[model samples]
Target: MGKGILIHLQDVNESKKSSKLDIWLDEERENLLCDITSLVKIESVAQEEDPTSDEPFGSECKKALDQFLYISRRDKMESYNHDGYCASAIIGSSNKTKPEIGIWNHLDVVPVGSGWTYPPLKCTIKDGYVIGRGVQDNKGPAMAVHYAMKYCLQQDLIKNIRVRQILGCQEESGMRDVKHYLENEKAPNYSFVADCGFPVCCGEKGHYNVTFKSRNYFSRFKELSAGTAANMIPDEATAVLVTEQGEKTYQCRGIGGHAAFPPGSKNAIGMLAAKLKKVIGRDKNYLDLLEFLYRTASDGYGRKLGIACEDELSGKLTCNAGILKLEQGKTILSLDIRYPITVSGASIKKQLYSEADKSGFDIIKEEDDPPYYMNEKSPFVQTLMSAWKEETGQNDEPFVMGGGTYARKIPNAIGFGPGQDRDFSVLGLSEGHGNCHSADEAESVDNIQKAVKIYVNALVKLDQWVGKGMVNNENI
Candidate 1:
């Protein structure tokens, strides 16, 4: 199989003017599969309770970090473990100077929920797909960049440019890994996070998570819980309500999807809340809260709350009632809102507070991250665009996304893709791959291979452009 891959590599090298990146990826396909599979099996789900002095995120996250660093060291690369928050592997110049380009990805995945044709932790390669949690959301893309660096190292393609691949272990949770790395290490002059879709993601909407809680709410509900993560639309929710005759149990079922794109998903939390309201009547304070959610939960544009807004660049604001729980006699609802680039967090918050006050709920906690954007005509974007068009023969323009990535955290950084918009149509899979925080997450091997090619070419082009002094890091 190895020899066959090499033969394909040689054939492509002989036939094409472009670099043999695609062929080299084909050659290393099995190795790529092995690397991602091995990393996936470690179950690197970040747990707040598992933090220690050595492992800030958790022991499982630390284990995943250790495994990644071990692979880097084995590949004869300079690697560092940053107190377990994140890890970095460097190829090219060994100088302590700043790196010219940075490739960022996350290693930690969201908690694997129930329902799957295969175990979520074990990598299952079947019919040209790599199925498992974190395969697409991050781990696979990270490995793709890793192997791209390996290709550059073997070909001695490292000239004046140095590439740093930083892998974080807590992206799905709170992105503290990258946060820790940036504090201890110098930020890359320019970076691209491999955590979005193809073409290029030049704009990302503001991310705000708001929690509504009230202890004074009148409720006959004894216990209720739904959703495992705040960024995912709840698929299943259950409530045990106190009734006049006897205690009653209720459940709501809906399709789960990424909170960023919530239009198609039927939020289970919202559904259950509506069901409870119907049974318990609308006069209760708890029902009022549920009533607000049930009315606006499915509206991605924030219309029912009077905060509906949109702009040409990033489109409309979206909101998802991601989590619902009854604890300590207080009913809590966690909302994940991705607002348009034009809207201010303050504006959104004011409207939300107004609605919450009217509904008799208090805003217990609110966290806001401003939107991130780069002018489409910048040298950085153009460089990546050229590489993408050259490799794919498509001239699609760079666009905005609702999903926030490390791009929002790093200066002049943007989200590039290992997956494309057409991936579903091409591969015959549904949006979010029926995984992405849902059960049985999987990423296509073919998509990973294509992304490897694009990354290699982009790195080569970026190195050349930076070496020629085309990009001014200070201005960028």
Candidate 2:
């Protein structure tokens, strides 16, 4: 099978010793931990952008980044900002032609979505886990990358390498802030977002935020509102039906999960609205939309519409009727769809509307994020995998993921470590007995160490890979 391009853990250890990475990392671990704790202590919530003020998520996020970069400023490092939406700090000798490597991370975190056993803002360390909201999702990795970059620059880890660390503020809701920077500024050469799991991520499915609204559908529907964000499915859906039986409250509740995996969900928004419509005398549009979505979304049909594209790595398309709202005579429903890489947004909309026309429901399109894919054998994937093997001794293969990250926003970018493989346990990654994005999110000390080492080592390999003409910059 092409000689199996996998490196063992022993080679990683020997290389670490030869490079003196372990010794240098050991000397800086305590300082790094302190910085990580401080960063996590600042609570950066995703709120509406204010044109007048500089601090949108409050000054905590901006303050944390400012303090972190203060060290760089003392060393006379290069830095820049974009409307307080984000900040990027860089350190290295002047070399523009060299492959500019970047470590991407977000500083602002999702608002504490209720259900927290401990305070979501404060960093709590108990049972060897730092319990907090941003501890795992991006804060931990952000801190780790910042410190790793700091150490690399101070120690001159890799000769003739340029590294930049970009911390994003509005990553939870949208990346318009980062988009503005890219349009107004320049893009990185080769980059890795340390926000997803390892062995590595080579692909991200297309994201479609579709809105369906029609004046005729659900004539008896009074009020409708479903989800919080386009990425999360609605756990609880509530609607008031103005039927002949008088106004009735129709409610549907389920455990909300990521929109990328919509099965097993009770579909609070869809079920409640549909059930209310059924009670008030079914509308063809309502019934058709429900049936079409259930059948097409679950893979029983609608393959021609690119709804059934599946791979051995990432699973099939996941659809969620997340948002619902009715005003005057018009009813609106927002659907969060994550289609496979093989699917296009146009094909999906055409198929959904082709069925919608028969039901008399008018479809309106909203946001669209194109699908992203990378070769599993690409240099970026190989270097990340090699670093993971060295850190954890796991020989895992790269794969695609359902959730989207900053990696997809830019070319030649993929998500690398900070999260463990399937077999490894991340006890403190979150407070909800899981890792990332969930409530009570935390980061373990041990996992942080491993993540720092992996990222640093990967950067080292990246330097060599670019020098040897292994990475293809034309894709960027």
Candidate 3:
């Protein structure tokens, strides 16, 4: 677990300026904590084995969705569940002349890996932070949006706008929940996903998942297994090798993070493969594959594969070998790649196939999703950035990201904050302490409260901006 600068709850209250929104947030802070705590205790990790016709992800996900809808109904907001994939709570009535804005969030969390001092399911409030699995990645922000909408409803501030908070249960696995929801409903013309950083995410790189399989035997390697999910960097990996003396076990450890941002976390599968290459020598075909992974795929860029590239807006292409396993005499390696927005999926595939042919591996399966980009000069992007700047007093420009969010799913959506770069630089704390998808995930209480205020301001501003026809509806 990463250590963060501990702050007391009192410090936040003292430092914040007294404003109507801030005062209201201060008064409702305890209740907000209670809401998050209650929701986190349900353990809403999606499981494929537990899936049913009624509960697509699992019963735990269904439980989380049901609980969220229950809270929305109690608050007197209109709530609806789309089968079992997703649920939504509408805070305001649609105005015939105004555009509806959607706030997208996820209820599902990643599996709780080992090494947690606090229980992963219990939302622990200590040292002015909410510590839990979903607190940082999504759950906390979802709750914040819930309260933001509630605030809008209570104040009757949503006169000419409609704000719908859509919570999905399959963001971690694949975005099937949102897909199902879109099938039944039209895409919101202007929306924001509260699953990323502030200053707004105007561009997102393309996403690709590729799996390599080889049936050829490894003479000296017996078994190898590592990784939890395709979208997360593997933190730990183990390999059993048939050595000269006997079977030998080896383990490698590295920091894990979301694959989109690989600089912060290390890849354990790459580490183990590099070590095994030295032991087994590079002459073997298996060692050759390991060498390819360690050299080209280990680093964020696709340097060794000769496909490393970048663009001015979305930056460089990144590749993470997230999953690796050797079973039933078949070795498999799964890669998560985020390519530059300017790059074509067909070009990337051709390059990958050429390299695989030379490296003695077959492409078992591949999935490609094109990049998503919004013009920074557009009214929608500017409005979101302006809202963030006004609230935080930060003048940083809107930037692109390698991570994919619900923003990509929605027609005209971008990723807005529950995180800010300053949280890591100035405050000595990263969102969730920079432990998303890793053990001991957490969210700062101060950040959560701050996010609520930002969301409230942004929603209010958007309502006025869109209601007045300041936005280009055609672009959306």
Candidate 4:
């Protein structure tokens, strides 16, 4: 764990704080915790999709949506669930009008894997932190934005500008909730998903998800179970092999984290695949496929597949073999890749398909989420950066990231704070505890308290900016 940048910024910024919102936040801290706790208790992990049902993702997601709307109504905002695919809590207008700013937060979290000194499904407010599965990844941040909207509305700060707070049900799976909403509704002029690091995100790497299967049957391996989700680095991978001699089982363990940020995470699947390849891999139909995948993307860098590239903005391309399965002699491997902002998704896919075809693999499923980028110097981006600077007194410039957020799916939008940069000293950082997808995910209460203030201020300024039609014309 590293010393957080927020700690330094807070040390300097708190001394100068004198806003009425800040004072109100201090008074309402306990209430805020209650609301956040209520949310964390819902096991809103995505389940089998039922398109015909109102709760398309699952009952838990629907329950999560209902809870969010309930909280919104409690906060005196107009709230509605859009057939359980997504929902909204809006302020500033009762009349039908397009929103100027949209705040996106997801209720669904990745499946809790292991390692917990605290509970994974419910909130555990300990020391100065609120710990749970979705605490930092999204739920806690979502509530911070929710409270900010509440503060703005009660203070009569939201005037001509209408803001829509969006709660997504399938962010963990594929963000189908937001996709369905945008397909049936109009998006806000400017939106920010508080799902990334503080300051601001000006660009996001292109998201390329692909799945390839073995061309021939590999009957030796009966079962291969690994990874919790497509976007999470696998912590434990197990392989069961049926050989003439006997049955053999192989298990590999490694540190886990969100696949997009693979620095701290160690890939267990890659480890297992490498070990098996060295020991028994020979034919392209069997263990050799794992060897090929591990060799191509083991390090999370796309250097071997000819997709190794970087830009001045969004850094290097990252490739994680996050999902793998073997059923009925077919070997399936799925990759979650974040490519450079400047590169063409088409070109990358072309090269990738060629490589797989030559290696005797069948490209089964492939999807391209094109890269989104805005000028760092753009007035819209600077305005967001200014809000962060005012709140934290930190001068970290607006950045581009590999992590995909609703900002990429929404037009002319960027990602703002609520993302913890690193572990603050006061949180008493411990090992085996992680943030976002990792187990025992945590969010400091102080972090939430300050985020509300930051978001409240940002919302006010963003409303003004959007009202002016200061759109990023170049990107749009």
Q: Which 10 residues in a row give candidate 3 its minimum summed lDDT?
A: 1-10
> Of the candidates shown, which would achieve the greatest TM-score relative to the real structure?
1
Query: What is the per-residue lDDT of model 3 for residues 227-295, given as tens digits with 9 covering 90 to 100?
Result: 878888888889888867999999998878888887777888878878878787547676677877686
Residue pairs clashing, model 2: 224-324, 224-325, 225-324, 428-442, 429-442, 430-441, 430-442, 431-440, 431-441
Worst 10 residues of 1 by lDDT: 1-10
Clash totals in order: 0, 9, 0, 0
Model 2 has an lDDT value of 0.66
TM-score of each: 0.92, 0.81, 0.90, 0.90
Misplaced by over 4 Å in model 1 are: 1-19, 49-52, 421-435, 469-472
Measured by C-alpha RMSD in angstroms, how accurate is candidate 4? Answer: 5.2
Model 1 clash pairs are: none
Q: How far is candidate 2 from the true structure (C-alpha RMSD, Å)?
A: 4.6
What is the lDDT of every predicted structure here? 0.79, 0.66, 0.79, 0.79
lDDT of 1 by residue, 31-114 (tens): 889999889998888877534477887788888999999889888888998888889998876655634688999888887875
| Winner on TM-score (1 vs 2) | 1
